[model samples]
Target: MLPFPSSSSSVMASSYPTRFCFNRECPDFNRHECYRPGWRLRNGDFADLCSRCASAYEQGKFCDIFHQRASGWRCCESCGKRIHCGCIVSASAFMLLDAGGIECLTCARKKVSVGPNFRPPPSFLYQSPIAEKFNDMSLDWSSSARSYRPPNLSGPSILQYNLHNRGDGYEFNQPTSRDKATAYSTEKQRGMNDLMGKLMSVNSNNHSSSILYNQKPGPNCKVPTCPNVNAYQPLISLKEGPLGTQRAFPVTTPIETNGHLGLDERYLWHKANSSPLSHLHNDLNSVAPLESKNLNFGIHLDTPGKYQVVPRYCPKVPYKNQVLQNLSNESVSVVTPLFEKILSVSDAGRVGRMVLPKKCAEAFLPQISQTDGVPLTVHDSTGKEWTFQFRFWFNNNSRMYFLEGVTPCIQSMQLQAGDTVIFSRVDPEKKLIMGFRKASVAQSSDQETGLNNNRESSTNGDAEPIDKHPPTEKKKSSMTTTRSKRQKVEKGDLSELKLTWEEAQGFILPPPNLTPSITTIEGIEFEEYEDAPVIGKPNTGLGSTYSANGRLSAEQDDEEAKDEAEGLLTSPKSTSKHPRHRNGCTCIVCIQSPSGASPKHGRRCSCTVCDTVRRRRETLLLRKKKQQIEIENKARKELESPNSDEELRQSANNSGTTSKNHEQRHAPPSKAQIDLNFQPERDEESLSPSNTTTKDKSPHHDETSCKPPSSSSVHSRHHHHKLHVDFADS
Candidate 1:
């Protein structure tokens, strides 16, 4: 507990030190010594008032600060006295409007006692039936009875209205206040017993404990000598059991303290009367024991928040390899080892010898002749067969049988120490099937390197410090050596072909030997010419086709050219020996004509074949030109208008007009000179459908007149061209 300050102490002298004056209008609010003197001395409490307020209090003039100001304290609306807001008893004390003013804590309680909804506290009803009877007989057993006073009810119910409704701004009806003296006297006369009786009677039927509190002694009571005990019927039993069964049941009468229930008494009574919850309690004896298999699944993962339990351990995963069968059928007579053995270093190192186990030799080699060496074949892991000479030998010292000559097979499989090797006899005449698994690093590398390392370590034992190097460096060096050796073998296998001169050039004779020097003839045999005068034979009148050197002369060449042009001889340029062809040119000479006659040489030979070819070429050129024109026209039309109704109509008309123009252009003509200029103009103008329609009408009107003039003009023009051509040639 905090120590209480004496009246003379500075704390009591100025409780609210350095605090502002309660009155806003006070001039001493900001001063250091603003506390009113002697006020605390008289009341044994610190004062909130300043010197000016104290002076006003002495002059019999009320300062508005006392009534209007709230200094952690408020003025009671009825008494006009300052009361601490924290000291308020209930919510009803402060929930007041300014016109109704604030009711003091004391007034608020008095008003609550007389309110319509107010009910007497549970402690007031906790009086034992014996105590109530004694009170009715006017016999007080305790000093509390004499000091007890009735609750005040005569005061106006100003603060009694519902405070909850005030938050919503609703008004409540209130009774008018009476004169102070009369109100006090009338309130003192109202007893608490009358109120308690009314509350008890009203709630008796609704509560289960009412009968207990209200029970009276019956005629058969054993405690009749004690009036209090007889009146309460202490020996009486209820349905479940006697009231004496409750521990400390006689002391259950509740005592009120600041409106709080007697919690200890109430709890004790409730514990004694309450029944245990039978359904909710678990029976520990019936629980099953934890199982091992289920415990594996119950283990949770170490990860946070996830809390996922591990799956059950499964042994089937590792044993799944047992399902695989041997290479040969089980029905056949075979030697199949149930388990493979790891090859040792001494066994794998030799390339020309092998030692077989006694069991393998006895099972597979029993029929072999003792004196003869047997040729055996063994297949490796990849199914590649290797032939080796095998012979069984019995050691005279050990008296053990062993098979030999597996070196080739072991070398082919590249077995090393710690590598597992298995053998199965698929066929007696064929090869023994062999399979192998690569050695684990720890087993192979450690065993092989340990020997080499030991030797090197022994050699350098005194040369270097023990901590000079680490084992990792030795391992790296060994690995690099192995890698280099492997790389060399790989390079040899994968390297490009190496070529020699004989193989690449496909000849073996030396360059100088192939070109031997030619030796000159020692003498020429000369025939003695007869001295008789040689007379030239009379010249045959035929022109020499070639000179003495086997070449044509200029005159002979000219004759050949002329003959070729005439289609009477073939030219030298023509490779074919046909007499009609010259310089690869196709003419009547080269092509067979329809008439079956020999062709005459000319640039413009009028043979049936030539004429037909010429006509076809002309028709092809015309058709190509027409197609090009149609493409250009279609592109132009598309550019001028997109696909629309007008374009469609225009296209339809253009198609019809184009057909009519084609018919007119190819129609049979009169035997007259055709108007070439007019024909070209008409063709060019047909691209525009609007213009073609206008030109088409004109053609229809002039058809009759135009034909006669065209015929006359054609005849005159042909006669003039023939006269001019004849004059120039002559």
Candidate 2:
């Protein structure tokens, strides 16, 4: 049975009913489960499910089950965070482990150093073999924010608190199936109807439910390819925005005066007085498992308003590291050094001002629109309950955990005028991340990636605060080192995370093709004759053209070559085209010479690439023929020679031929003619007196004794004789 509001007004009631849940309609609600004689149910006490879930909750009695979640607590043992639960935890598992002496599902352990200055809380009730919880509300959570050696705080969590801050309502909880269909109808009212097909995600729109990254989308999200992927980026300058400060794009005057947003002191104080509860959530492990039907309980601060709604089901994934990453959403929002101020006012009359959202005049599907489906207004209960949507915005909704201090200066560590924080929303709705943060440290390496290059002296906005104390040595539960474990916890499953709204910029509308009426190359720029002057040469200074990060600066490249450029338009003056002049024709010698007068004989005018290819092919073919004939002759000699058997045996030893065998196999023969008289065939013209052999000597490089052309300059004629002679000689 789920816990319900006590007959008492306050959520944290001391005495709870034993037998049954107060909500009579609930099917599983127990009636007389914990009927202790001394039970006193009150309005301020936690009311239902006390008697239903446990008499004593012994070991293994549905121990791994997760129950609903709650908010508003104190410091983490690893990271200095104040929240109800440290991170995502399993209720059933916590109970089971408590009985088994292992309280933390996360594989971590700690030892607190007892100093006179270091005092344990007076009401130290929560403790397990792994983690000890603080019961006293007076304990300053900020002091424990890792200031000591081996700072006793949980590492950064992967939880995100419900910024909507509604209690037990759709404003804070995930939406139900009924809510989704209802939201379907209102989809027509949105500005982006093109994006409003049937969008669905694993998680509903609410902060109470923790979500891990899931690879699927909601049932209604559009299926079009991302419009931002392949197209030219919007010509907006990455450098020209409001630098070193974090302010959204609605213009306003400088600080001190009541700014254009009208964020005055009156509104700030009213918010503090309104909600008695400081709602909190974690992103790291606070996510509820998807299959489990556990309800997550966060402080829905709108006690005076109408009923808020949240999703009926939220799934949990692991945590993620934030310092080194950003969601691949629409143009990644550059982290401004100064955090932007966003205020969530549920009561329009109470705040007394209207926020003017610039009409989404342009077309880029950023998550936020003028409507309520965005983080500014998530219908906690799966979009079913429309009126009870939770409104969220960036720094406007900060959990107590985000306020950890550099103690001794705890009082001085209030959020000042120029503080900023960046956040990513993961909404698979399967897991309930209470509030998790990935620790990030600033480094020069970030500069090379073109990430946050415009950031100034105060870089903390661009970088997340790293864990002040990284754990040393191995943890007991097969957990990696502290940093690695924390990193894994923070980087939740992304496959499950789907964009509720997206406008992809990658697609480019193709241009229509047209046939040319005339063909010409008159305005081209290539050759430089006497009539035309050479303009720009390729610059050899690779360094000035690029940064160390390998990003070539197109602007710099253009500046260096500006003198040589020409344009057909009047704006950019066109330069004279390189002149193409004809040269007079010459004889074969002139053509063959470097002057290139005649194409017939000039090497310069010939197709050098084709000539090289033909020569290579001819050489390869000749080599193949010669090798084949040598093999045949060698085989025949082995069959006839008397010494062949002994030679073969000797060659077989040593796993190869000996020097003598190699000499016989590869040696060129000396010219041998034993008879004084030569028998001459008609083919052997040199031997016939009637046909005399004439030798003409020409001086040439020893290496390049190209075949004596058949007395012709043609390449084909020179190789033909070589081929015929080799074949005949063989």
Candidate 2 lDDT score at position 266? 12
lDDT of 1 at 96: 28
Give the true-structure RMSD of model 2: 30.6
Tens digits of per-residue lDDT for model 1, 454-572: 32222433211111111234444343223222222222211111122122112111121122222112221111111101111112211111000001112324443233222221112
The digit string of per-residue lDDT tens for model 2 on 51-122 reads 433322222221223211221122233343222221122111121110011122232222222221222211
lDDT of 2: 0.20
Q: Local error of candidate 2 at 511, Å?
A: 50
Task: Give each model's clash number.
Answer: 1, 136
Task: Return the lDDT, model 1, position 213.
Answer: 36
